[model samples]
Target: MPHAEAVALSGHKILAVGTTSEIEALAGPSTRRIDGMGNTLLPGFVESHLHVFSGAYGRKLLQLAPITGRDALHKAVRQFSDANPDEGLLIGQGTPYGILEEDGPITRQKLDEMEPVRPLILMAFDFHTAWANTPALKAAGLFNGRDVGPGNEVVVDQEGLATGELREKNAYLPVLNLRTSGGREMLGMSGDEPETPPSAQERADDIAVLKEGLRYCAAQGITAVHNMDGNRYMMELLREIELEGEMACRVEVPYHFTEGKPLPILEEASRMSADFNSDMLKSGRVKIFVDGVLESGTAYMLDDYANAPGWKGDPIFDTEAFAKAAIEIDRRGLQISVHAIGDGAVRIVLDGYEAAQKANGARDSRHRIEHIEVYHPDDLPRFAELGVIASMQPQHPPGTLGLPLEPGISAIGRARWPYAYAWRDIVDTGTAYCFSSDWPIVAVEPLIGLQATQIRTPWADDMPDQRVSLHEALEGYTWRGAYASFMEDRTGRIRPGMLADLVLLGGDIEAVVPDAFPALGPVLTICDGKITFEA
Candidate 1:
């Protein structure tokens, strides 16, 4: 009974973890007891890559474009418009290519009739493209058919008229601002309070949203998350949360860098990294976009798409510019995560990393290439040789299966298609890799991502050979993701002394049908010796 007398929470940190009886002995007379009921425990799960603010925003916005298809999209958008007639812009998010039934892109003319006066900006499921109406285009100063410049494009017709299809950051930023501003306004308008500019107060509200989202993640057993996008405001919010002792999850925030910007990189990085608290909130790495998505044919490609003839993909930054940035960033002892979906884009990133190494000797910088969807056979070994991590999303291949069907299969062709999710080959060659949901672009559920890895075949009966073992798939989500974020030593595995972040499943993963894993739900989610979520 003396053993039970000991209150075993070793001073706010897990002082000792043992059987209930052993732990009980350490309990003091005033010790509080919590019943475990023989439930399974695990280390908390960590999400390697995600846009936290955007994910929360998406949850608030119109869910017009479900990844399932276009009819659902049209119905959802129409319903939202019908209900919120006073809103200036009819906005929606998440529409993958495979879901659309329309032959061509979603045009402005189609959305014009619904609310011809109000602007409309419906983002593609991938967030790499946008479907804007004429009003939205005009509002964004992209009415005329012209190159909006760098990482942005306006899809045009034969006569050079804006087709309402905007690709990459070019078309996305303007509309993105409109959505952000508009969402804030909506939040203010809903209440009987005076609407002010989105000051620190608004951001505090957003921080509250983030905390709620983190709680949701913890309940699902996520212990850490690699936040792909977080600005100074977000960082401030995080600091506030930490100071208030409200921070419960470990977050690795990556600073974003654009091509032309030079001075801001060091200024921002130094400011952020100088004060970064490694305990729970730390700076992860720097993020850059080298190319767009493969489904949109905007990703830089070595060869032309089978459907879109005379068109190889587009690159956001030229080779020289990319190389220069990579060198400077690498020299600063910061990791780089570049978005490169196509083979050509991947090659360009590789070339940049190689240039950086040549300029400054080989360092332990674990530079990463995000979305290496298509890889040239020759460049497969470069990942391992250069020590680059392939940060990929498995759901893209299975989710975008209908891409070949729409816009003609000629663009992708058969030979190049087999190399989409080449996880086995990448690992065989000694390259490290990780997986993410790219949530809001796709579903945030890790099970869906794992399922895609196990069954590489598209919705149709194609490309079965690309499928990988379930263990390999799970590793990508758990261990590989941790390695990419540089948290391998602290998280990922369910070992003693690690943070008590773990998930309890309704059923064992090994016993369930592989394909049905996507439907599996978490029964409990624990984070940092606290219960975050309980089903």
Candidate 2:
């Protein structure tokens, strides 16, 4: 953490970092020098969790505000369906929590009034719950009310027919899987690979969408991304981008480890890891979902929801099953990152990691919990003890992004506010935590996350020391993220010989005053040896 006044770049590595005079001496006459104009410089942001293709796909769908009332909801749905007349399914994203007039989830019956012929699906921001029209339900072959094991429901009406509201991936994936080249990639479930890969033209479309998404990330100073989705289709799409020389930033896809999939999936994870082990495009990790998100009331919790008595949300994998999978994956040496949002879910995931350590012996396994949204006081120490990485998205906190207070905050109840979004708590307990956007779930801008990280009101009253300084928040988005992804040796620093990945802010980031970080962004972004974006 040296105080650097100037840095000299030699090819793709830093040649010198010192006072302005010392760095100037190393700069050759041919060097291209750009004055900072008083803006701060730092390593490019490393986004720890985002689904590239899914996000690209969401970019195409209609985004509805959670509270868009009944009439407006229908009007927008009809307009989108009419606009895309050729589309078999008129999909929508960013649907609000209480779009319908009544409480509980909006039913498919209501959607049918908007467009009875075309299939309609408006998914929740959390991606766990979705409301569909009758046509969409029939399209997924669940209109007859198909049962999908424990913890997943199709929301049948009193007549025993599907109501078009689906809960959990087990319920909605049936519809998503029907989309061409769309499947369990979002859930990170292994073996849901499409029976037929994307055709040449489809890959062309994928390339078009994904390349644009990558550019958007680069514009925000994102140098590297730890993509949370995995499947052979996405892997192939990224490979095509790298082969065509369209890759502008580093990308890594995980091996989605899901339930009911055999042990053979872990072996495929190893093979995929070895096949695409390059800096630009790679795969050497496994992603799992221990529970759903809190917004949907599916986030497994130790205590029952304040709204629902006698029941706490359940984990996707039973205790013994998770233990087995964690042990196997840990032994394989591939990194493990799980989506655990609730305190109960977090505890189980930690227990599984502890079991893996005991069974496979210890290694530098930087096992991660994707969203430790609500951490139990008791389980707070397990993260440090098991050497877990707390992968969090600051933007997912309540009272931001137009999120209503009910679902995200109230679902956990007022009593747990101190423990929810406990970034300061985890850091104080000596666990390494990294930040991500979880794009398509919230705003993707790291700047927005940084701004959200500063809000400690009410929460400050509960914890008194939950707010983080700007530097610590910046580190969570940089070097610590690199460390979480096992890429610290080459990236995430401005020292000599390290990668030449830097972002120049247009505005003076350090002088922006507290609570004004949301207004800042990069003016120029350089990745590797190339300048990817320039304002």
Q: In lDDT terms, which candidate is top?
A: 2
lDDT of each residue in 1-535, candidate 2, tens digit only: 6356788887777777888888777777788888887688889889898876667667777888554688888888888888887776777888877876553568777788888887778888878888888888888999888878665778898998998878877898777655543322243333367566656776677677778878888988888999887676778888988898778788998888877788767998998999989878888999888888787778899998867777688788877888899999999999999998889888888999999999989899999999898988988998899999999988777765556776677688877878888788889888998999999788777887888777645433545456677888999999999999888998888888888888887777778764676566688888886788888
Stretches of candidate 1 off by over 4 Å are 1-41, 67-74, 98-104, 179-197, 399-410, 458-464
TM-score of each: 0.87, 0.95
Q: What would you estimate as the lDDT of candidate 1?
A: 0.69
User: lDDT by residue for model 1 over 1-535, one digit each (tens)?
Assistant: 1112222343334556556677777788786665543333444556777776577667867775434555566677778778877766677777655555553457888757544777788777778777888888888777777666765688888877788888876665565455534344122111112235456667777778778767656655566787776655566677877777677677777777865677345557656766785767887477888888766778778988867778886688888888988888888888888888878898999999999999998988899988787889989989999999988777666434233344323455666766666777777787888888776676677776777777554433665366667777767777677788777776666554555556666655767776777555667765566666777
lDDT of each: 0.69, 0.81
Lowest-sum lDDT 10-residue window in model 1:
185-194
lDDT for 50 in candidate 1 is: 72
Residue 330's lDDT in candidate 1: 83
Superpose all Cα atoms of candidate 1 onto the true structure and report the RMSD in Å to 1 decimal: 5.2
